[model samples]
Target chain A: MTALIDIKDVSHTFATDGGPLHVLDHLNISIEEGGFTAVVGPSGCGKSTLTRLVSGLMKPDEGEVWLHGERVKGPRSTVGMAFQNPVLLEWRTILDNVILPLEIVPNKLSRAERVDRAEFLLGLVGLTGFEDKKPSELSGGMRQRASLCRALVHKPEVLILDEPFGALDAFTREDLWQTMHKVKSEEPFTGLLITHDLRESIFLADQVVVMSGRPAHAQYIMDVPSTGERVIDDLYTPDSAERLNILRHQIQIAQGREPADVEAAQ
Target chain B: MSLKKIAIPTIAVIIFLLLWELLVWANGWPNFVMASPSDLGPAYVRYWDLFLINGWQTLWRTVAGLALAIVFGTALGMIMGFSKVMRDALYPLLVGFNAIPKATVVPIIALMFVGAHDFNTVLIAFMISFFPIAVSVSIGLSTLEPEYRDILRSLGASKMTIFWKIALPKTLPEFFGALKVAVTLAFIGTNLMEIVSPHGRGLGALFDSGRTNSDYPLMFAVLIALAFLGIVLYYVVVVLEKIFAGWAERQET
Candidate 1:
């Protein structure tokens, strides 16, 4: 079966004041339709750059990015994005903020239909009564939830989450992990998450890809063993611990603290 | 609005007026040398007609000039905000023009317009006021968060879409702030033109008339009227700011 998203030998560089800064080096990734992939690595590993390329915000210098078998030349309307800052419009209420994308992307939905759609997602995220509240009125975690609804409101073919929950507290982050599962089970859009948390990657994603430090490429790919339904307790199980251990050791190799051949020798 | 908000400023003004009256009484200054707050009441009643006519003229001139400034400043600001090349080219010229003393420019404008009294007043007001609006708007737009634009761009939003949805709304608080400052500058501009070219119109011309006749009470009354006008216009902007960009004032709980 063909993949819904494909990145082929992609390489990119930035022209900085100090000559060129190479960011991505011959990176390759592919996600099947409805797949959830989490990318984790050392800080500044070009993970965010990868999201930009996949979402068609920027073009790859050396290779092609294919979405649903179509070459992405510019920004695509079928990709949704969320960031660490949430970035909700201060002038708009929660409902209106979620309805923003519909106003931009061409659609046959009526105004009433758009509101209904946004309202449905807001309800799913447990923000039913906050329809009229301004972004400032919501808590940080609640704002992030509203941001998630906005990304999915457009019903995009792919969702790119660039550390959407990175700013939340530990408990809030865990709660959002559950919310993610709920959102996925119902909405079923292809998701690409970039995170610094290893446990977060293993818990939420079906597949976790570890990337090398800057001038990064895909260094390790681990397929999470299928469990019926994931819960917070699943993170503490022996199976989960073993997988986390391996992933952590791979990250050490990626960060250059451990020799590359150590894992191979084992 | 709260009573405290209103009462506090009113009390301050009354105390200020009383202090001025006490100073005049203590120094035994003549009316020509200094008119006390008590003296202002008679002067106001005596030249009430002049105050009405000239004050109306100044108010309209300030408003008209400010409306024009809003139009021209927003256009110029959008250009500077959107295009880096335009910002680089036009910003220096704008700064240079704004740097010149508006008082000196008033006589030059009078010379250029020669008998076009109303137009000169309005033009001066627009010239002095437009700079703040343009500078504030450009600063607001240029400093906008990139992540906001990226959110829309990734969804295939056009430049125009991004501007209407993101740029315009985000710049409103700053725009209103500039407008508050611009309104005061506009009053100064209108008065400058009126005084420089004494065309028998506006509060500044009225003040000039009182000066020539040695009517110190009339002069002080006109100054008070001008202050009252400035205060009223400033509050009008504050109200509009509340209506439009009230979200910026939201408190974190």
Candidate 2:
């Protein structure tokens, strides 16, 4: 069966004053419909580049991106994205910000239905009372929560999130993880996460793909030990810790920081 | 807090005026050479009618010229902002116009366009003020955050949609900010035109007449009038910004 988003042998080069900088080389990823996948790499690796490529926000120089088995020629409305910074337009109130995607993307839904969906999604993220407040009035976590609602309000088939919780504190990040996961399971959209947090990957994704440094390609993929259902606490187990260690070891090797990391850990 | 915002400026102005009066009195200059603060009150009372008429005329002409510039300038700015070809073609021309001293062009406009007093003044004001507005708007549109734009495009928004929803609203605060500078430029443009050309009752001519008549107090009065006009115009821009672009004031994430 065709995956919801398929990236085939994609490579990208950014022209700089120095020369052409290769960011991704022969990168391939397939996200099955309704499955959550996480991509982890070093800080400067091309994980975010892959996120943009799959969302159809950009073109890969060497390969094509496919959505539902069709080649993506330009940006696609079937994908929704959130970033580390919520990027809510300050002028817009929370409710208006969440309604932004629906306003931009054409749909047969009436304005009332759109508002209803925005409100419903906002409520889902536990931001119901603060809808009337401006983005400036909210905390960072609340702003990110509002951004998540904005992304999901349109009900896109695929969701691309680039380190959306990386800026938050540990507790806020974990809280949002619970909120996001609960919302995703209920809505059942394919999710792609670009992050470096190992425990975050373990708790949230069905599959965690490790990546190399610049000119990034997937180094390894690990199926989460607990596949059926997960709560944040489930990641505290010894087995989950072992899985985290394995993923961490692969990432360190891919990043070329600690080749003997595994043996060193013992 | 708001009271403090008002009181501090008011106190500063009073201190400045008092210091100026003391400096002039201590210098012991003759009244013909300069007017003291005491002389200003009588001078204003004597010339109140002239100031009112000329101030009204300047006000109308400034508004007319500024309105024309706003319409054409906004369209021009958007076109240049969206198209690199348009920006490149117009950039040199705008630079050349800016490089020329507007004062040099004022007399030529007066000599070539004889008898259309309104037209000459309006053109002068338009010429001086439009550059800042157009350039600011173009820059604002051109420099929009790429990440926000990606979000819009990923939603399949059209270029026109991107412009209205993102570019235009984002540019408004900058555009409004430019208007504050543009209003002062409009006053300067009007003064330049009125000095050389036939501005029937502008403050520029009134000040020139005071100079010719050796009426120092009258000159001071007209300067005061012009200063007041500047303050009023500046505040008008401020209030408009509050209504239209207030959201930009907050620095939240």
Candidate 3:
């Protein structure tokens, strides 16, 4: 499969009061077309920074990032992004928020087309009747769902999720993971997820990349078994627990912690 | 709950007006010195036609000035909001200009636009009203949520697209708020110009003439008429805000 994204020996640093701080060091990775990949690490491990680099929000200090064979210079419409916070526009209704991306795209669709697209996406997210509600009127999970619909409305090639579900409660996070899985099953696209949830990474990702603590570097890359028939119930199985355990151990090593302690905590 | 809210304010206004009327009656002041509410009422009825004409002229001048201020102020504000270079270069100058007492410049304004009384009144009104709009709009545009801008940028939205879709809409609530104040200021500015210049038929001209000749009843009538006009114009802007910013206001509450 062709690589849709290529990060070639990239490094990034920031000038701080203490001194020059290295965030990512000589990172090299490539995401294949239509693959669902997750980057996991400890807090401050620059996982989110990597997502910013790939999405062209920030530039690397060294090397290059190529998207669809072009150098990643600045933000591009071909990528959709969602942050940990839902960040829905408070002044807009749920439907209007979903239609925001369409407003920004060049030669935007007509009002009728835009409304049709918004309604379809809102329905897809189970918010069909709540279209007129404002962001403040919705619960946290519903707000996040609306945000997800907004991100996908423009149909970008790559979806960059920087802990999009991190702020949700456990149940909501799990529910959204399933919702995401179902969405991907129907309309698959390349995704880059930066998350700290070990089980979440193992559950949804086709491959999981572990990173070392800040001055982050890729420490391990493990392929997840693609159980095409696996459903949400499979997450509670012993086999799934074992895979999660192994991934947790890899993360512990990356963070310079004892793997045994991490296993015990789990 | 709604009844109590309305009842309280209505009762307060009635009591206040009654006290004023009683004070004038008890003092037995001459109508020339202080016209009671009864005297003012009859005077208003007698001069209603003339008041309406002058009132309409003042209202038109206020609206024209306010509309021009909105157009120019919104454009300048958007430019200042998005461009750091423009902000740095122009913001201090804007602040300085805003600080000068607009009333003090009435003579200069009249002199500059000699032979055009209505135009001078409009010029003064525009000067008074434009500053708040520019300041409020710039602040609103500058304070957009970072995530919203990020969403637009990630979508490869062009500068114009982002300005119209994100920046402009974000400033509507603030613009309307500033507009409310701007309309009131425009009314005051027009009245002040008429007071100083005293050329055409206007509430201010009527006021100047009444005060000069000790036509206390006419002056009192015009004052009431001006107050009514101000209240009506203010509520008009409020109604517009309720219509355009309905979604945003709901979010706040």
Best TM-score goes to which candidate?
1
Candidate 3, B13-80: lDDT as tens digits? 77977887898989988888788777788877887888989999999998999989999999889888
Sorted by DockQ (best first), the order is 1, 2, 3
Query: Candidate 2's residue-wise lDDT over A185-207, tens digit each?
Result: 67778889988799999889988
The lDDT for every candidate, in the order shown, is 0.93, 0.86, 0.85
Q: Is the docking of candidate 2 incorrect, acceptable, medium or high quality?
A: medium
Per-residue CA lDDT of model 3 for A34-69, tens digit only, reads 888899988987887787888888899998999988
Give the per-residue lDDT of model 2 (tens digit) for B112-131: 98878878998999999988
lDDT, model 1: 0.93
What are the models' TM-scores?
Answer: 0.96, 0.92, 0.87
The 10-residue segment of model 3 chain A with minimum total lDDT is A225-234
Scored by DockQ, the top model is 1
List the per-model TM-score of the A chain.
0.96, 0.95, 0.94
Tell me the docking grade of candidate 3: medium
